[model samples]
Target chain A: EDKVVQSPLSLVVHEGDTVTLNCSYEVTNFRSLLWYKQEKKAPTFLFMLTSSGIEKKSGRLSSILDKKELFSILNITATQTGDSAVYLCAVNLSSNTGKLIFGQGTTLQVKP
Target chain B: SAVISQKPSRDICQRGTSLTIQCQVDSQVTMMFWYRQQPGQSLTLIATANQGSEATYESGFVIDKFPISRPNLTFSTLTVSNMSPEDSSIYLCSVGQGTYEQYFGPGTRLTVT
Candidate 1:
């Protein structure tokens, strides 16, 4: 079956620390991998990686995809309390149905 | 990016009752979906609302329990029927702009007493 697995279910770190969140998937016909940041309300889109080895970055946040390994990693540099949220990774199938298989997610708590 | 909104941001209802959550997108989207998130859990796709057609439900989710409506491309609704305490969850509506991107609404928090 198609499934996405994220490592380090939960993590606590002090402000300014760097943390890496991992996501691995096993699915038929891989298309793209997406990352989302979910807080109290809803999840917000973070990054979508379709190619391997190329890193997508925004400010202190960056992500890379490794299709050969069927995994992805999200890195946050100099984390802040505002960065505390559940990071979700989802795999979009090549079927083009827009159906996403999501990971359990990694909860990051940045303490000040 | 598409802007999405949902009504009844949070509500508490008694068991056996039902609730319908509304999702509206600022732009016409190609696909819309309903998802459920239990506390501290990952989001699970409930169904895909197809415009002018019957919604396609996922495994473990039935139409009788969670009927969906997609009257148009910009709007959809999901009804949680015969609610129980176990049904209490955060219901989210998401819109697919194209092949790779999907945006989520604010979500409705439902509590069954």
Candidate 2:
């Protein structure tokens, strides 16, 4: 069965702290790993990592995938209250359906 | 990325009533998907709406309970029939526009009492 798992289901940190959210998956054939951020509304796309070891960054957020380990990590630096949201990870299988297998997501609470 | 919109951002419905959510994409897409997210839970794919074929539903979801219609490439609707408190959740519509990424709508928050 294809499944995705995220670690540290929930976390809390003060402003300016750094956090790493982890996601691991097991699928038939891997195509890409993606990250999303969800607040009160729908989820917004964050990062899409197709290659291993290469880090993708946007502002204070960065993510990297490790294909050998079948896992990915999302790192947030200088976290702020505005950064409080559930971080989700999903895998795009190579089978061409565009169907995504998503992780449970990690809730991050950044306090000032 | 395609821009998607959903109608009735939030609604309060009585038990046994039915509600239909509409999803519209700015650009034409071949495959659109509907998902449900309960409070504090991950998203669960309800069905994949194909333009010319019946929607393919996932486990624990059925066409009778959640009927989907994809009349065209850019428009789709999902109707939650026989609503219950258990059905209270956020329903999101997403489109895969020939890419690995999907663009999501604002989602409709349904509260059944």
Report, for all candidates in order, the number of backbone clashes: 0, 0
Per-residue lDDT tens digits for candidate 1, residues B2-59, read 8899999999999999999999998899989999999778999998899999999999
- Give TM per candidate: 0.98, 0.96
Worst 10 residues of 1 chain A by lDDT: A92-101
| Candidate 2 ranges beyond 4 A from true positions | none
For DockQ, the strongest prediction is 1
Give the distance in Å from residue B34's predicted Cα in candidate 1 to where it truly belongs. Answer: 0.3
Task: Estimate, for each residue in A1-112, the C-alpha lDDT of model 1 and write its tens digit.
Answer: 9999999999999999999999999999888999999988699999999999999999999999999999999999999999999999999886557899999999999999
In order, the interface RMSDs are: 1.0, 1.1
Question: lDDT tens string, model 2, A1-112?
Answer: 9999999999999999999999999998888998999998799999989999999999999999999999999999999999999999989886466778889999999999
Q: Model 1 Cα displacement at B75 (Å)?
A: 0.5
